[model samples]
Target: MTDRLPLFPLNLVLYPGLVLPLNVFEERYRRLVRDLLALPEGERRFGVVALRSGREVGELAGDPVDAVFPVGCVAEVATIRPHADGRFDVVATGATRFRLLAVDDSGPYLVGEVEAMAEPKGDDAEVMTLAVSRAFAEYQRKLTGAQGRGPVELPELPDDAVVLSYLVAAAMVLDLSDKQSLLVAEDGTVRLRAELSLLRRENALLEHIRALPAVELLRQGTAPN
Candidate 1:
């Protein structure tokens, strides 16, 4: 079913189950937050779409619809603390995925017509989940060591494949486009497979250059270690 939702264009991607904290200082977004707050507890939500190309603050150039990715996650408000100066500190969790169908810019903030998306566990979800868990653990260790953080205590990976997929997608320090790809993946198995490949690639690069960022590693064309 399709529904209308308030839209917030951000520079980052938010996967289902991820927790996002926002400082609402922008006038338009403040209005969005106020509107959401007026709704009942369970009904407060806004769509968070990753900006394709544009600043998160200020005015978006050209068309607002063209500035963001069509795929987005609904942020369900958990807590809202309003400040004396009209600013708000809000904590929300990613609840559901949605596909933006159309944008109405007539409002103070962008409002979108969206259709909710379903997450299916595709073929070989169990097998791929195991593989991804192992790969991600190693990737986490290497990433921590490379950042001069020494050893890391790997968190226990979630057993549910869908949860695992979103956890890795949200936790990994990947580029915006890469993270968005994971968000828009067809199913749990597909997301896990993509993450496994990404982990291997990142792990290889981290082994070669123990301290450089992934962008630098790519630029330098460093071979796998």
Candidate 2:
């Protein structure tokens, strides 16, 4: 489906099925929250595109087209709390992937002409799903130990390959570009293969280093996935 969506360019990538919490402290984003709140419950959503080369809180020096990645996730508001100070505490869940066709910056916040992306389960999706899950389990174990925490407990994973892929993409402690690659993968099988490679690389690094930088340092100001 093709439609225009309010856009929120962030420093991080959001994957489908992941939960994102935001403190709407910026005036433009506070306005974005108010506008979404006015919509019907099911229709309250916006596009969350990762910034390519600009800060999330301010206007870019160049056009937004040069500042944001082409692919983004649709964030559907799940819960919202408005403060007396006109800020909002909003919890949104990633609903679908979209390709940004063009940008509109006349409004307070960015808006996009976006087309919903097709979600395909490629031929090897089932096999790759199992492989990625095993790799991720080991990766999580190593990551936990590296964090000085003992024994990672794997969460209950969904059987659907697409959901599983996005879940792993969200849960992994990786760089923005790495996660963005996963987000833009053409299908579940492709994403799972990429993730398998990433998980192995991370697991190896963790094994050799035996330590990791604090997650907060890596994730910066973003909410926990």
Candidate 3:
């Protein structure tokens, strides 16, 4: 079934179960925030589509966004802070996945007729979830080290396999195409497999870099080498 919801097109992708902090400075988006907060708690849900190309609203001048993968996760406002400058600092938590059907030009923000995506299912889902979680833990460690930070504290994620898939999807640094593929994946198993593959590739790259002798490599092109 299709339903109408307020759309917020961004330059980033949001995955279900993830928390995204947004700074609402533009007048149009400030209006969007106002309208969303006015609604009842249960009805305060919106879609977050990544802007493929375009400047102003209703202008389709930029490169066309990949229509085949035009779905984004629906998010609910978890916290809202009104600023003195008529802007807002809002934290939204991904709630459900929604597929955009059509864009409506009724409000300051874009509105879309969307259908919620279904959760994944399978038999080996539990094992897949565990594996994905492990991968994320390792990735988090590497990320923290790379950022010159201490070890990261892992969050208490759900035990269910499907939930794990969403968590991994949210954490991985997947490109647009991979992210879109995850959004349209038929089940958690498929998404988990994809994320695992991505993690493995990243791990391989990191390992390759770590194995290289930094000093010697740097000395190769130096004078009198």
- The residue-level lDDT of candidate 1 at 220 comes to 17
lDDT of 3: 0.69
Model 2 lDDT tens row, 32-87: 88899889999999999998844654756568888889999999999999999987
Q: Model 1: which residue pairs collide?
A: none
Candidates ranked by lDDT: 2, 1, 3
* TM match of model 1 to true structure: 0.92
lDDT of 2 at 128: 93
Candidates' C-alpha lDDT: 0.84, 0.84, 0.69
TM-score of each: 0.92, 0.92, 0.79
Prediction-by-prediction clash tally? 0, 0, 0
Q: In model 2, where do residues sit more than 4 Å from their true spots? A: 216-225
Instruction: Give the runs in model 3 whose Cα sits over 4 Å from its true position.
Output: 53-69, 142-157, 211-225
User: Residue 116 in model 2: shift from native, Å?
Assistant: 0.4
Error of 3 at 174 (Å): 2.7
Worst 10 residues of 1 by lDDT: 216-225
For candidate 3, report its TM-score. 0.79
